[model samples]
Target: MRKSFQKIAKKYALLKQGWSPQQNLFYGFLTYIIIGCILLCLPVSQKISAPILDHLFIATSAVSTTGLVTISIFDTYNGFGQFIIMILIQLGGIGYLTFTTFMLLSTTRKMTLWHKKILSTEFTLPNTIKIKDFLKSVILFTLIMEAIGSILFFIAFKNEGMPTLEAVWSSIFHSVSTFCTAGFSLFNNSFMDYVDNNFINFIISMLAICGSLGFIVITDFGLMIKNKSHELSFTSKIVIYGFLILLTFGTAFFYFLEPSIVNLNDSRFLASFFQCMSAMTTVGFNSVNFGVFSQAMMLVCIFLMYIGASPSGTAGGIKITTLTAVFAIMKSRLRGRSNITFLGRRIPYERLYIATSSFIFYSSIIAIGTFLITLTHNFKFEDILFEVASALGTVGISTGITGDLTTFGKLVIIILMFIGRLGVLTFGLAIWSKTITENERKVLKEDIAV
Candidate 1:
C-alpha cells in the first residue's frame, strides 16, 4: 500500500512538472478569462444585473482584446468594472509571455532557460534580434507610446468641451485601448460623435498604427538608431512597404466605394482614410455606422481585417508576414522557379511552411465559425460573415449584429475571438504539441496531384 501511494505521488508530481510552453500560453489566457469573468460578476462591478453569459462574453472579449460585446458596456458595468476591463486589455495586449517575463525580471532580474523557451514560442524573432532586446522593446515602447497618446487624447477631449475628470478618464482608457488595438470605447457609439474631429482622428490613428506595427519594427528601428551601421531587417521592410501599399489602396478604394463618405463632404477623405486605418490596424474603431456600408465596401473591410496587422503585436489575424510569404510562394511557382523568392531575396523554407500553415488554419477557423454561427442566427450571410471575420481577426467591427446575437452565436464569436488572440498558428501548435512523441517509425511515402 505504501509503494502504491508513492507511485501515485510520483505520477502527480510528474504531471505537475510537464507543462509545455504552448500549454502554458493556452491555459494562461483561459485562467485570465475565468478570473475576469468572476470579477465582472461581483455586485460592485455591475451597474445593473445581467446574465452570467453576457458577463462571461464580455470577460472573454476583454481578456482576448477583442471588443465584441452583447451588451452596452457603459450601461452594464460601473467604473470599477470598466477598470477591470482596462487591466485585462493591457494584459492581453502585452501578452502572457511579456507579463510573466516582466514579472520574473522584476523579482529575480534574470530569466531561466524555460522562460527563454516560452519567449521563443510566443514570438517569431529574426536571427539578428535577441530575446532580451525584444522584451525590453515591447514593454518600454508600449509605455512611452501610451503616455504620449493619453496626453494627446486629453487635450483633444478637453478642447471638445468634455468635463475635466471625464476627459481624464476617457483619455487614459482610450490611449491604452488604441495603442493595444483593443477597440474598447467608453463612448456608447464608438467615436461616431467625433467622426470629423481631426485631432481625435489623428491621435487614434497614430496610436493604432504604432501598436499594430509590431515590436520587431520598433526594436529594429531602435537598434538602427543606436548603431549607425545597423539597417532595418528584411522583415521590417516587408511590413512597412506592405502596410503602405495596403493603406493607400484601401483608402482610395474605400473613398470611392463608400457612399457615406460623400455625405461627410469636407471630411470625406478623412473618413475613408480613418476607416481603412482602423481595419488594417485591427483597431476596429468606426466613425460611421458599418450597417450602412454596401456589400462591396463590407468586403473591402473584410479583406483588411482578414490580413490584419504585423505579428508579435496586439493585433490579431494571420499577420502581414504570413500573407506576404504566401504571395511570394505563389509568385515563385508562377515563374516556374524551384526556389521561393520575394523582392530578389530567396525565402526560407521554414517561413514558407509557417505562412502556409497559418493561412490554411486561419481560413478553416473562419469557415467553421461562420457555419456554426449560421446554424444559430437568422442574420444575413454578409452580416454573419463580417462578424466571423471581425471576431477571428480580433478587429471587432460588426454590421450591428453583435448585440442581437443569440447565446450560441455569441459563444461561437467568443471562441473565435479567443483563437484570434491566441493566434491561429499558436493555437494549432498548442494543441498539436500535446500529441508529439519521441518514438519514431518509418513510413512509406505517397504522392498526390495538386
Candidate 2:
C-alpha cells in the first residue's frame, strides 16, 4: 500500500510539472473561446436566432482577431453582441496573459515566476523590460492609441450625419477593433463605401499599422525616436524596415496591376494603399470587393497576407522577422558566406534555425489545409489557395466563399485560424508538451537523392 501511494504521488507530481508554455497558451485561447461562445449564444447577445455552430465560429474568429465570418455582423447581432466581440478582441489583442497579469498585480501585487515566464513569452519581452513593466506599457499604449483613434473616427462619422450617440459607439468600437487588428466591422461591405473617404482610409490604415508593429516595437518607441540618443533593438529595426518595404511594394504593385483587369483611368490608389496595409498587417478591412480583383491582384494580396505582420502583435502570419530571416539566409547561402548576415550584422545560428523551422512548419500547413479544404468543397484551386492563405495568416479577406463552405471546410478553417493565431510551431509544441521526457539522443545524418 505504501509503494502504490508513492507511485501515485510521483505520477501526480510529474503531471503537475508537465505544463509547458505552449500548452498554457493553447489552453488559454481555448478557454477564451469556450466562454465567448457561451456568452454569444445567450438571447441578450443576438438580434435573431443563431445556431450553436455559428456562435462557436464567431467566438473563435473574434478571439483569434481574424475577421472571417459566416454571416453579417450588423444584420445578425445586436449592439450587445457587438460589444461582447469587442471585449474579446481587446482580450485577444493585447493577449489574455497581459490583462490577467495587470489585474493580478493590481489586486494582489504579486505574480509567480511561472506566470512571469508565460507573460514574457506572450508579450515577446526581452530581458531589458520586466514582466510587470511590459504589461503596464502594453495596457497604456493600447488605451492611449484606442482613445486617439476613436476621436478621429468620431469626427469622420459625425461629418457623415451619424447620430451623436451612434457616432460615439461606432467610433469607439471601430477604434478598438482596428487598433486590435481584429477586423470585425459593423458595416456590411467592410469599408467598401468609405474607400474614397480620405479621413476614414487614413485613420484606419494608421491604426492597423500601429497595432501590427508589435508590443516590443511599441515599447521601444522611446529609444527609436529619442532626441537624447538611444539605440533600437535589432528586432525593431527588422520589423520597421520590412514593414515599410512590404507597404511600398504592395501599394505600387497593386496600383500598377489595376490596369490588367479594369481600365486605369479612375484607379483608386487610396484603396490600393489601404489594401496593402490591411493585408500585410493581417487586419482584414477591405475598401474594395474581393470579387472585383483580378487573379494577379489576388495573388499579391495572398503573398502579403502570407507574410502577415511583425512578431508579438495582434496580427498573425509567418511574421515579418521570420520572412526577413529566411530571405537573409537565402542570400547568404547564395553568396557562399560563412554566416547568415542581414544589413551589417551577423544573425545567430539559433535564430536562423528558428526562422527556418517557423517557415517550414507554416508552409507545411498551407499545403495540408489547402488539400483538406479542397476535398470538402468544389471551389476552384486558386480560390481555395487564397482562402487557405488568408485563413492561415489570420487575414479575413475572403474571395467571397466563406459563407458557402460546408461543415468540414469550416472545421478546417477554424483549426487553421486557431493555429495561425497561436502560431504554427507554438501550437505544435503545445500538443507535444502533453508528454514530458528529456531526450538527448544522437542520430547519424545520411544524404538522400532529391
Candidate 3:
C-alpha cells in the first residue's frame, strides 16, 4: 500500500511539472472536491441514507464554497459530516495552494523558483511582496478576522438561548462560513430567520464584505495603514471604491424597488443593507426571501450576483478589477485616448485584454449554462437564468428552484459551480493549454468586424 501510494505521488508530481499554474489550481480544486465527496459518502458522514449523487452534490457545493444544494445541510449531514463540510469550506475558500505554500514556508522561509512561479500565478501577487509574507498575511488575516466574527456570533447565539456547546460550534462554523463567503448555513432558510437579528446580520455582512474585498486589497490596506501611505495601489483603490459604490447602489435600489417586500416591522435599513451586501459579495445569506421580491428587484439581484466579488479572494466573480478595467478601457476609447490610463497609471495592453477576455468568458459560460439547463427542466426563463447566474457567480442565491432540479439539471449546476470556483479563464487554460512559444512564432493577425 505504501509503495503504491508513493508511486502514485511520484507520477502526479512528474505530470504536474508540465502543467501551468492555472492547471495546477484547476486540478487541485478538482482533487479536493473528489476527496470531499468520497468522505461525505461515508455511512457515518451522513445522518440519513441518501443517494450517492446527493452526497457528491453537497461535497462539490461545500468545496466550491457555493451554497447551492438539493439537501438541507442542517438535516442531511451529521455533526461529523457538518464538521467535514466546514473544513472543506475553509480550505476551499482560502485555497488549497495557500495551505500548501504555508506548509512549505513553515520549515523554510525560502521558496524555490518553481514554488515562487506557481504562487505568483496562483494568487496574482505583486512582485513587491515576498511569497513568505504574502502567505503569512493570508493565513493571519483570515484567522484573526474569523476569530473576531466567531466571538460576536457566539454572543449573539448565546443571547438567543442556544446552548453553550451548540452556540460556540455554530459561531465558529458560521464565522468561517460567512467570512469565507461560503454561506452554508445550519438554518433551513439560510439567514431568513435572522431577518431582524441585528447582531448576526451586522457581523455577517461585515465579514462577507471583508472576505470578498479580495485578499490582495486587504494586504494592501494593511500596508497602507502600516506605512501611512498616501494612496492605495490602483488595484486596491478600484476594488475598495467599486465595492462601496456597488454596495450603496444595491442598497438604494433594493430599498426603493422592493419597499413593498421589506418587512416594515423590522429595521428596513438592516433588511435592505444586509441583502444588498450579501448579494454583492456573493455571500448567499439573505435576510429577506428573494422569491418574494418584486421582479424588478429580483432582476437587480441577478445583476448584482453577476458582478459578483473581487479577484484573489474567497468569493468568486468576473471580479471588480476586471470590470473596472473594462469601464476604463471604454472611457479611454470614447475619449480617443491613445493609451488606457487609470488613476494616472497607464494600463498595459495585456491587462486590458485579460479584462475584456474575462468578461467575454463569463458571459459565454452563463449563456451556455442557461441554455443547457433549460433543455432538462421546464422552468421560467427568469428562474433558469437566475440559477445559471448564481452557479456561475459562485453565489448561491437561488430562486427557490435548486431543490427541484432533475439529475441532468443538478449535473449542469455542478459543472457550473466547479468552473465558477475556478475562474472561466483558468478553466479555459486547463482544457486548452496555450503556449507563448506558439503565439510568438505565429505572426498572423486578423481583425474581426466590430
User: What TM-score, computed on C-alpha atoms, does each candidate reach?
Assistant: 0.95, 0.92, 0.96
User: CA lDDT of 435 in candidate 3?
Assistant: 76
Ranking of all candidate structures by their TM-score, best first: 3, 1, 2
Candidate 2 pairs with clashing backbones: none
In model 1, pairs of residues that clash are: none
Q: What tens digits encode model 2's per-residue C-alpha lDDT throughout 51-145?
A: 78888888888888898998888887899999999998888888867877788898999997767767755656545545676677688889999
The TM-score of candidate 2 is 0.92
Question: Tens-digit lDDT track for model 3 on 265-377?
Answer: 45687888888888888888877777767778888888888887778887887888888889889899999998998888888898889889999999999999999988888
Worst 10 residues of 1 by lDDT: 434-443
User: How does model 3 fare in lDDT?
Assistant: 0.84
The digit string of per-residue lDDT tens for model 1 on 318-386 reads 888999999999988998999999988888999999999999999999999999988887899999999
Residue 84 lDDT in model 2?
A: 91
In candidate 2, stretches whose alpha carbon ends up further than 4 angstroms from where it belongs are 1-18, 106-110, 126-130, 223-229, 260-267, 434-450
